[model samples]
Target: MAWNEPGGNNNDPWKNRGGRDQGPPDLDEVFKNILNKFGKFGGGKGGSSDGKGFGLGISLVVGLLVIVWFISGFYTIREAERGVVLRFGEFSHFVEPGLRWKPTFIDSVLPVDVQTVRSLPSSGSMLTEDENVVRVEMEVQYRILEPYKYSFSVTSPETSLSQAFDSAIRYVVGHSKMDDVLTSGREVARQNVREELQAILEPYDMGISIVDMNFKDARPPEEVKAAFDDAIAAQEDEQRFINEAEAYSREIEPRARGQVNRMAEEAQAYKEQSILKAQGEIARFEELLPQYQAAPKVTRSRIYLETLESVYANTSKILVDTKGSGNMLYLPLDKILERQNTSNAPSTNRRTLEGLRNQDPAAENGPQDTGIRSDRLRSGRN
Candidate 1:
């Protein structure tokens, strides 16, 4: 029954509807009053209901914010990179290549590319050992080997790396000769730079590994380039001249030595021939002297006859004894002598006069005649 029914007493019959001993209001009424209080649109009471509604709405917004906060803590890492987690600005752990999450607002993550090669160029002017200034250009290739160290050990790794490169270049170049730096020193310079840079980075814990370094160009300053080129050309010309002189020496020295050796050999042969001929002539004279002592007269006659025959073989004149024949035989002795002195002397001197007999021979051959015979024998020997 409703409380505002017309049949109801002015005292409120509904008050007694359940019973005077009822402990509290009806359950349905209690629920109805609670719904009404919540459903109010305006006023302090309505505002209180609105405050409850606003509290509920605030709770729902707070729940969504919490969900988003949880999601924001999660992160992802790619295959080529490594993640370093820092808890309160200090390194905590490392994560690799996948989805990962860290405590929100309490931890931070830094991703470093460990596999990718990074390049930095270094260039500057430096003094060499020869006290020459030159410009050098080079590139360094590096990669991160320790991600945690790269992220946390140094505040600025790239800056430190640049400084290391500068120091290495200066140190290497300062000690090198200008010519070497411009030419064959490129390889040496790269090696030195790599070593020095590695040392510097290791001490600072930069976590960088140098893969390779390359020298791009090294040259003298623009003001001195022409002079350097001229010097190089001069060096080349000097080497060429030296090579040509050496070649000429090689070609001529052997020929000159051979000619000298040939002359020496010819002189030696002539001396040996002269000595052998003198020895042979001496031996023949020794043998003939013994034979002549055994038969003096016979040997003398034979030698005289042989000498006369050899002397007159080519002569047309007849030598007749003037004492035996009063008529003198006119002989061309001058013509025979002239012919004997010419080109046919050797062959003409070989004939002998065997059958000529002297009608009026001179008494014994005297010392003058013997001297004449000796002269003829000596001439034939010669």
Candidate 2:
């Protein structure tokens, strides 16, 4: 039956025992009743048991809250990261990679990647040392080295690094020539910028190390880009020409040296040959001197005959009989020369030809067959 039925007891679902107009049961009273049940174990009286129960309940709640806060502070650091711990908003220490815990409300942890290289780019139109404006772009790569300084040395390490990069790049570019920034000096400029950036950041101890700096792009303003391009091309061409000339010199120098060495060798050989030939001739003359001094006339005649033989050895010979009828008779020495083939044939032929040239007409007084005999025979016939 509904509690409000006329025959049944009227029970007010929303009323307490005082029955005035309570909206719901009082939470404090409900809690006290529940704790009193626990307090029964202590065997306390009415008010003392209730008070003891409330105190135990409050202690349990505080202990549970403390445990939850401690557990919440536990964190994990990755392999590539470092945890920068702070005690009451002040730098404390660095935590390595692993599961770690800290006082939840007292200590805070900031995880930073120390192994990863971060890059920042700086680019702008800057004036060079040569009073020329060039658009330059550069990249700065860095890694967190000291997490404490990176977190506390400055409000923002990345922002500070970026500003430092700008400063360094501008300083380097301002001191360098436009041609160098855009040409063969790019590497030098990149190294200088990296050094300058490191120097600038060292004073602040931003806890970041400059890994490298790259010269990304360097060019003149668009208004003058064409002219700069032409100049760069001309410079490249000049370098190419120089390299080619050097290569040519390298190639041709060896060949020229070889020729010079060969000529020197040939000259030395010729000099040796001439010296030996002169010595041989001097020895021969010395040997002949004693023979000439022993028998003067015979030696002289022998020398003359040898000289004649030597002279005739190389010439063709023909015997001419000029004493016959005022006409000359010629002997065919060429045919005889063709028939003779001996090692000493030239010397024999030379001696024989010389003897024949010197011979007198056969028995000059015995046979006087001249033109007068021809006249006597003609008169007899008449």
**Count of steric clashes across candidates, in order:** 0, 0
TM-score of each: 0.50, 0.62
lDDT values, one for every candidate: 0.76, 0.79
Give the per-residue lDDT digits (tens) of candidate 1, residues 1-382. Answer: 5656678434564455556633456899786565445445323353344555545555666899989889998999999998888899888888989998777989998888999999999899899999999999999999999988876678888988999899988998998899888865679878988898788778898788899999998989999999988887887798899999999999999999999999999999999999999999899789879989998876776677666655565456444334444555555654776756566654444332322323213213422365654454355444
List candidate 1 segments past 4 Å from native.
1-45, 50-55, 232-382
Model 2 score (lDDT) = 0.79
Estimate the overall C-alpha local distance difference test score of candidate 1. Answer: 0.76
Cα deviation at 305, candidate 2, in Å, is 14
Top candidate, metric TM-score: 2
Error of 1 at 284 (Å): 47
